[model samples]
Target: MTLLSSCTRAARISAAVIALLACGSVLLQIGLNLLGGEPLAEALWRMSRFFTILTNLIIAATFAVVAGGRSVAPRWLLAMTAAIAGVGIVYHALLSHLLVQVGAEIIANHGVHTVVPILSVIWFAMFAPVDGLRWRDTWTVVIWPVLYCVYILARGSVTGMYPYPFIDANTLSPVQMAINIAGLTLFFLALGLLLVGMLRLRGRKSAN
Candidate 1:
């Protein structure tokens, strides 16, 4: 019970970090889009990567909390974050970022680019448990991530320019894109619900 009671404050801290990161990323991209000057695309891309990085940091901090015996994650949430980041980690680790390549070719050929891949690796480690590798814990950790994804997707359509390549509706076949977006949306929804559940659990623990 004491252990259960301890997780709430720390958990909220992790969550707040994620919220700020998401908001910051979106705002930065919006600003750069408006500016439309030299180095703007690179700036936008870098700012966008910070959102992903903060998310990864949040995940990392979540695991740190859980492993400290302060929190526990539901099995499904753990599996989902791991599964999603796994694919992303592999691709970014092995392949190249289009922004780095194309933006260089089209705009600034000699500029340095350091954003997506670095954050991808950082977020990939978000689920690591010091006690051991634990896949049963993603609920609390991934909540902000999922919610922000929805916020971004919905907002992106209105503003234009998605954070990443996968969800660009214009680039995909119509049927396929809807299916893709739907699936992604569910994952985000699940993440948000899981976080809410953990907070509820914390409440219950405190009430007792």
Candidate 2:
């Protein structure tokens, strides 16, 4: 097989394995934390408050793209996964102290936010299909995050608990929170374009 094809196959296998490991780490941590405290289902519901968990789910979905091939998964799903992974990495690096926990939590935290992001980026660079992606599609990347923001804010409104400090309307005014959300949306857009650019460059290089 050609070198690119070989690399693509390797990337696919690696993506699937990394995703599985990340999921396992997360589940193990949750099980450990809730061992004597709450039901597994309740613990999982609480854990879903963190965007890191959601991003891991996105990463897990990307595994389908890699394993099942381009025809099986849409390009938008790949773009969304990469966008969230980039956000997860940056957020964890900067705001880890706020979300810090002990023992199994540490493993789950880094597995999803740190390790998964890095490997997902590598997988996308090496294997994500880019032939049909366009700059115009970058806006679609903002849709998921926007909807998530709405959900969290609405949930926080009722529960009086925000997942992240930045999104905590109790501490920050609506205007301030809006600014933060706008900044994050812009960041996602930029990263989405970057991924698209990288994929296009690789596609061109492979074509040549």
Residue-level lDDT of model 2, residues 1-208, one tens digit each, is: 2223334667667867866966776777687768758888888877787777776776676575555544433355555555657656667667876664877777776777777777777776776665656677677777777788998988888889888777899999979999999988887888878887887899889899
Please, what is the TM-score per model? Answer: 0.39, 0.85
- How many Å off is the CA of 49 in candidate 2? 1.6
Kindly report the root-mean-square deviation of model 1 from the true structure over all alpha carbons.
Answer: 10.4
Model 1 misplaced regions, further than 4 Å: 1-51, 67-69, 74-84, 93-149, 182-208
| Worst window of 10 by summed lDDT in candidate 2 | 1-10
How high is the CA lDDT of each candidate model?
Answer: 0.44, 0.71
lDDT of 1: 0.44
Flag regions of model 2 displaced more than 4 Å.
1-8, 68-70, 99-102
Residue 35, candidate 2: Cα error in Å is: 2.9
